[model samples]
Target: MDYAKTERADALAAGYVAGTLRGPARRRFEALLPGHPALRAAVRDWQDRLMPLTASLPPVAPPPHVWAAVERQLWPTVAAAAPSPWWQRLAPWRALSGLALVAVVGLSVLLATPPPAQAPVVVVLQSTGKDPAVAGSLVASFSGDGRAVVARPITPVAVTTDRALELWWAPLEGKPTSLGLIRADGVTVLSRGRLPGGLRGSGIDHMAVSVEPPGGSPTGQPTGPVVFYGKLQL
Candidate 1:
């Protein structure tokens, strides 16, 4: 169904859910939701129905205390209903602490060690020469032989492209993975996304990209040519 009813407000309403409407359109929707229950319901319904198609996924189970936390969220007047203190009840803390300490050590090692300039993990994003393209260095790390990532977008490139630019991470190993697309604006904080199976620390030797269609490579693989490719030499 066409979401917009030719009404300015309805058009904004549709854009809010579809995520196509931004800035003023988004603000207008927020202002409209509470006063407009039908609009709210429409957005919620669209969210519930079309949400599966989007990138957001269901949550993994939180700790047992999470239910109490939810209670706190929904019913603030109610006290946290925990029979025992989590730290005392769970003996797993000792093991977890040990792991955490080991992680700290590993991270220290990583911080101290610099990546070789020739590493395969270093991938550059190449774009049309007409516009100043985003330069980035993708670093592949691993925990217990699983590929983890640390992508640092370099800003030195004098970006001058008219088309709104965004950065997407596509894994060379398995299915094209999303490292969250960048916003056209310079400072979009792309949250850490789910890691690919082969990328958990092994088999991830390189990274590639096809110019994504706007929000990203719509087909999940690069529909555009591999603008930039690199490998992990670390």
Candidate 2:
């Protein structure tokens, strides 16, 4: 096939290596990998190219069972000719508690859980100054029954003027995605309907507050320094 289509196939190649390729696209790539050695090389090349982006990532050692699960998937049909790193055995999903649920109830389940309880306890994310003066304070609370979190900005934050703060939960080891932009009294409450399996109770390893751009970080990845990082405890 043509590896030079649509800007020289870099995007497609990235998606393929990232396992985001699906349906006919993935099937075509799989079939192509065996017969067209160059295509195989391209897949490997792309994976190698992006491997470092995730490196220097202060390794998030998966649970002991993670490697076993990985080997289970890999040992079935092994390839001896490849030269790949141990990390290559990893899948980004295994790192997220949502993976197990995604495999089971699927993404739709994120919307299916029951309603919140009546005894909700409020948790707030305050600005770095730790002054509690209410400039960039964001607040959220658990449903009285503790099924989900109601999160929202308490104020309007302009990155240039009022330091932008983003909220994140360690669904696993690292937190990705914005809970949403926050500021004092901006968004009264954001109801977290269902916490990913990873972030439930002590299940949540950690929670963080980041200083970000006005609208929030452009890249899905975090661009700002962590302002506050604390473990989730009972």
Task: Give the candidate number with the greatest lDDT.
Answer: 2
How many backbone clashes can be found in candidate 1? 12
Model number with the top TM-score: 2
Q: Write the per-residue lDDT of candidate 1 for residues 109-153, one digit (tens) a residue.
A: 889976432211223333333322544222222222233333333
TM-score of each: 0.32, 0.36
Q: Which stretches of candidate 1 lie over 4 Å from their true place?
A: 1-150, 158-175, 183-189, 197-202
lDDT of 2 by residue, 70-91 (tens): 8767884553444665445567
Which segments of model 2 are wrong by more than 4 Å?
A: 1-118, 124-139, 145-148, 151-159, 185-187, 191-194, 197-202
Residue 67 shift from truth in candidate 1, angstroms? 50
> Candidate 1: minimum summed lDDT over ten consecutive residues — where?
136-145
